[model samples]
Target chain A: MDIFLTLFINGLSEGALIFLVSSGLAIILGLMGVVNFAHGALFVWGGYAYVWIYQMTNSFILGILAAMLIVFILGIIFEKFFVSRLYGNAPAQILITLGLNIVFIEIIRLIWGNTPIAIKKPDFISGTTIINGVTISHYRILLIIIGISVLIIVNYILKNSKTGMVIRAGVQRSDMVQALGINIRLYFTIVFAAGAALAGLGGALYAPLAGNVISTAGANNQILAFIAIVIGGLGNFSGTAKASFLLGLMNAFVAWFIPSFAVVTNVLVMAIVLAFKPEGLFSEGRKSILRLAVKK
Target chain B: MKSLREHIQRDFSKNVIIALSVLLIALLIFPKFSSYTMLNLLTRIFVISVFAMSYDILRGYMGFINLGHAVYFGGGAYVAGILYNKLGTTIPVFILSIAVVVLYSVICALVMGKLSFKKGTSVFAAAMLTLALAEVVRNIAESWRDVTNGTDGLIFKVPSILSNRIFFYYFSLIFLIVMFIILRKFILSPTGRVIIAIRENEQRAEFLGFRIENYKLIAILVSGVSAGLAGLVFGTFNRFANTELLSITYSTNALLYTLIGGTGTLYGGIVGSIVVNVFQNMLLNLRSIHPIFERWLIFLGILYIAVILFMPKGIVGTLRHFIENRKVKSDNEKSSKTEKAPGE
Candidate 1:
């Protein structure tokens, strides 16, 4: 029972981080039709900023907030400078984003010198809490709460906000949105920046969870985010959240029972998902979308 | 005489002659310019260029960016490495190894293709799947150390026939040239035209009665076969195969080469491969001269960005544009001279 409980919490915490990173990716892909491979770089930059700030100021909240703000600014700059030029061409966008990713990853390595930095939970949340004969770290439980809170806030904005409405309309048809006197190009820029900020937030939060921040981890997280987005359905926020949770649980369970299977399990799941629903679990309307596109 | 000249002009006879001459000269003189070590390095580059060509068949012709292509190439290397260790050095074993790798690649392709059949999975999704699968394969290769020789990487005595670095370089060059010929024939063939059409518009091609999936599958298979051949050559040349060869870097390198060479032209793949390899070699060699130049990844990233922004059409495409422009200019000049009126 303890083992199961521990696994569940661990998985949930990991899933939360995955959800934070992937939601940004899912939203950008769904609404703007831009596959930002540099999302991973944002995550990496966020972590590095947090660590740098924390080392300088020694205040966790300030460090994290500063990091998030930096990422937000960087995201906006990136959209304006780089992503703006690659609005419609996916292959070119992918190449540019990949190039940006390499530059960011290398910069991190150059600055940090390839050494893993130690990341600790703030002193206030440093202790463990025992409940129902199961011991859970307080920071981990905090992670779950934080994840839920962010999800609610984001979902609320996505569903009810005026900008969210614009995003939905743009997703339906970029040209039609422009026809309606809305500048979708501007919306796409804001969306990319927002996505970067969210990814930054996820990276900042994940620092303590993983106990270290490293350069290559962004690539690893990027892969995980991609897998999550694909499984959950490429533009669906809810689907990504659910898929992240399921994958997290799956990894935790596999690790406990058969540790070797933990890595392979993700690939096996992807293969199965690809076989069963190539459009993904939530891509119900893409067929019609494709048909409409073809007619045009 | 005019009709004969026109026929010769339309046939690409001159272009073929120029390309072959350049290739022949490079193959013969490259060894003399560089030492044994450099010869070996160039040979590896040639093999990898062939691998990039494999990727080009899928990415350029079939319009499918397969992220998992290293599986076949790496599989062949491992197969050959294992075979060389267990069974004595025999040419037949190399052939069998190639077959085994091709079979493995085909099975993997069928599975990946079936899963991604809906609107043919997005480039990002395919890349993610392949990256994940490569990691899985890497883990398997690591854990199954008994067979893979684990982190040490499987190494064997160099094959007697290819013991001389120059001999191996020449052999690989021949293999690359032959593969290029095959690829040229494929791209020029009716089937190749259909593949190109699918890349332009899959639904339209399907409406035009082409079996889109079947063609994609065949393209993938041919690509796998080429990768397998490259892998066999790589294993023989390096005398070892490691999990690194099956990494995301390998896939990325191939992708980068295709992008650099100009995917629209057959020779672009070869040019891209050579360019990147030469650049890398120079960077590594000059590390002592400029310590900061050790950051090769940064340079490569900048290069990728530059290529994407300025040379979107790639090297061959740019060259073709210039050549066509010159021809047009000459034709205009000839026409102007023939005209008697000043307005003309």
Candidate 2:
């Protein structure tokens, strides 16, 4: 029972961390219909920025915020210049973003010297507690808190805010939104940057959990996020959240029993999903062409 | 009677034929006069150029991007290494490996095509799926230590006939020219034109009662078989097989080659491969002169971006576009002059 509880918490925390990364991807893909291949690069930058600032200032909050800020700026640049130019051209977008991915990843290696940088959890949350015969780590609890809050906050925004309304509309028809006199391009930049910042936040939190920041981590997590997006349905937010949790729980149980299966789980799940339901398990299956391309 | 320049200008095909035959003749005699390094380098280019050409069938012709393209190439090399190691490096074993490679490439293509080419699958989904599949294969290869040698890479001996560098160099050159002609023919075939039509307007192709998916699957199969063959030749040339062949770097290298040379143009891949490989070789040579030269990937990435942004049609595509535009301009001038002559 104690093991079960531990695993559950562990899994939820894992799912929450994944959520932080994939949520941005889900939003960006939803709003802009832009598949940002350099998202992994943005993620790595976030992690390195977090590590750099954390080491210098020793303030975890500051590091996380700084990471988000740096990545946000990078996101704006990518959307405005490179990705914006290649709108509606999926192949070119993929190639250009992939090129940017390679360049940015190499730049990370250049700055950080190609070695993994060690990191530690903040002093406050780096502790353990015993409750009702259950041993729970404070950090996991903190992760759960952060994860739920982000979900609730984002959900609230999507449900209640004008920005959410625009994003939702943009997903279906950005042109219609533009015809309605909303600055859809500004919204594109905002959503892309916000998604990038979320990825940055995920990276900052991820470093202490993994115990180090490495350039390759971005690629690895990017794959994980891709899996989530695939299973959850393209550009579906709530679906992404559900899929992320499902993956996390599945991974935790698999790791406990069939460790080898853990490595193969993502691929297996993805392949099965693709074979059976190419639209994804949680897809709305809209016949909207605009979401497929934000054409000029 | 026209001067030599005017005659050549009027008859483009004859001039191209003359230029190509002369180049081919020179290359046939190249090994004897060239140094060993030059011979080896050209041999490598010939083998890899086939791989690039195969990649162009998908990227250039069909407008599909398979990020796991290196899997077939890497799979071919591994098959060669493993079979040679297990069953003795005989001519029969080499033949057997070729057969195995074709079957393997076909099976992989079927699986990849079925998943990525499904109805409602977006461009993003296909790209991500292929990448995930490639990574899965790489992981499996890594963990299967007994066979793949656990990423330290599988090195084995080949038949002595293949080991003869001059013989192998000639072999690869023939392989390149033969494959190029075959692919060019394939592109011009009825089925190939249907595939190109699908690329131009998938909806129109579908509405025209063509099974676009089947055509795409065929494209994948042809590309796969060619890539696998190239990989086998590359392994024979180097006498080595590594998992790095399966890496995204190689897949992207294929992409870079096709993009630089011209995606749809069959020979563009050859040009791109030659240009990229030569540049890579030059950079390696420059490493002793500067520490910065060691990090060549930065430059590779920059080149990728620059080519896509500035040279979107690639070297061959851009050149062809320029030539076609000039021809149109000159023809317009000649037509106007003829009109004026009638008036006079």
Candidate 3:
């Protein structure tokens, strides 16, 4: 039971981190209809930024903030300069974003060198704590808290805020929104950057949890986030979050039991889900957001 | 003599005939004067061009974006490598590898087509699924350390004659010509027409009583077989096989090659492979000039973006567009000799 509890939290924490990345991805896909393949690069940037800041100041909060800020700016630049120009063009988006992904990842290697950078959980949240019969790592619990708070905060904002309404409207009809005198382009940039920032924050938090950050982690984690987004339904925010957790739990158990299956399980789930439910398990059976996203 | 000359002029362009003969003659004798590196680069280009052409069958001809195409290409290489390692490295083993690759490619294509062509699967999902399926194969290869050697990559011998550089270059050239002809024949066949029809309009093709999925499967089958064959030859040429051959980079390289040369045009793949491989070779040569040249991928990625943005139709496609446009304009002028010409 104690082992189960530990594993459960471990899974949840893993899911939380995945959610951080995919939620941003889902939002970007929803509003702009562009699947940011460069998302993984952004996540890597966040980790490197966090590591750089943490090493300089020894402040975890500052590191996370700096990571988010830098990634947000990058997000804006990507949207304004690259992604925006190719709006409504799906294939170009994939190619350009992938190109950006490669370039940025190479840039990371250039700066950080090829070695993995090590980091530790901060002193306050470094140790494990016991609650009744359940013992949990403090850092993981913090991650869970951060994940949930971000989820709630974003949910609240999306539901009640003007920006949220505009975003949802833009997804349905960006031209319509533009006709109404809303600068849809600005929204696209802001949302893309915001999504990037979330991925950055995920990276910042992920470094301590994983013990180190490596350049290759971006691609590996990007695949996981892709699986999550696919299973959750592309452009469906809530579905993506659910899929991430399910994947995290599955990964945790698979790794714990049959370590060899760990690599295959994520893809296997994606295949099965794709085959059985092409619209995704949680999707509302609306048109494929992808079809709607592309230019005629 | 005038009749014969008129017949030749009527059937084919004199420029095309002259160009083809000149290019073929040059290819035949150029290896004698070329550096060893240049000779080998051409050989690699030949094998990889076939892979790109195979990819064109799907992406250009069928409008399917398969992110896991490396599965067949890399699978062929691995099968060739593994078979050569386990069995003896001989001409017979090479023949046996061809048989194995054909079977493997067919089965994988069927499964790949099935997984990605579900009832409600979108193009995006299909693409992602292909990537997932590839990752699964790669994962299996990585873990199955006993057979695959666990990503350290399998090094093995090839048939004796294939090891010779000049022999292999000519051999790959012949291989390229054969595959190009075969692929062209396939594209011109009735089944290939239906596949093109599906690409142009899936619904209309379905309504016309063609089983869209079956046609798609057929396309994938042909593509996989050819791509696998390319890999088989590539592995033999390299005397090595690695999981990297099964990676997204390799798959994307096929996309890049096809895109650069212009998709759908068989000759474009040949041109693309030559252009890309030569460009890559040049970049590698520049490594002595600057340490940054070692990171040529950044430049490659930038080139990729630039191609997608500015030359979306690719070199051949754009050139064809221009030539075709000019021909149309000239034809219109001939038709309306007195009327004002249409605006560009």
The interface root-mean-square deviations, each candidate in sequence, come to: 1.7, 1.1, 1.2
**Which residue runs of candidate 2 sit more than 4 Å off their true CA positions?**
A132-134, A168-182, A284-296, B1-12
User: Which lDDT tens digits does candidate 2 get at residues A141-236?
Assistant: 887788888888877886689998887777667789999999988988888899999898888888988989999899889889989988987777
In CAPRI terms, model 1 is classed as medium
Ranked by TM-score from best down, the candidates are 3, 2, 1
lDDT by residue for model 2 (B1-344), tens: 23434534643577797998999999999988998899999999999999999999999999998899989999999999999999999999999999999998999899899989998787878888888888888888888999989789989999999999899889999999999878877887788889999999999999999999999999999999999999988987888888789878789889999998989988889999999899888988989998677777888888989999989999998888998899899999999999999789
For each candidate, the alpha-carbon lDDT, in order, equals 0.80, 0.87, 0.87
Worst 10 residues of 1 chain A by lDDT: A287-296
TM match of model 2 to true structure: 0.94
Better of 1 and 3 by TM-score: 3
Worst 10-residue lDDT window for candidate 1 chain B reads B2-11
* Model 3 Cα lDDT, one tens digit per residue, A125-240: 89998997798899998988998888888877776889988877787788899999999889888999999999999899999999999988888888899999899887777788
The better candidate by TM-score, 1 or 2, is: 2
lDDT of 1 at B205: 95
Q: Output the worst ten-in-a-row residue range by lDDT, candidate 3 chain A.
A: A287-296
Off by over 4 Å in 3: A131-134, A284-296, B1-12, B333-344
TM-score comparison, 2 vs 3, better candidate: 3
| Model 3, C-alpha of A102: deviation from truth (Å) | 1.7
Full-model lDDT, candidate 3: 0.87
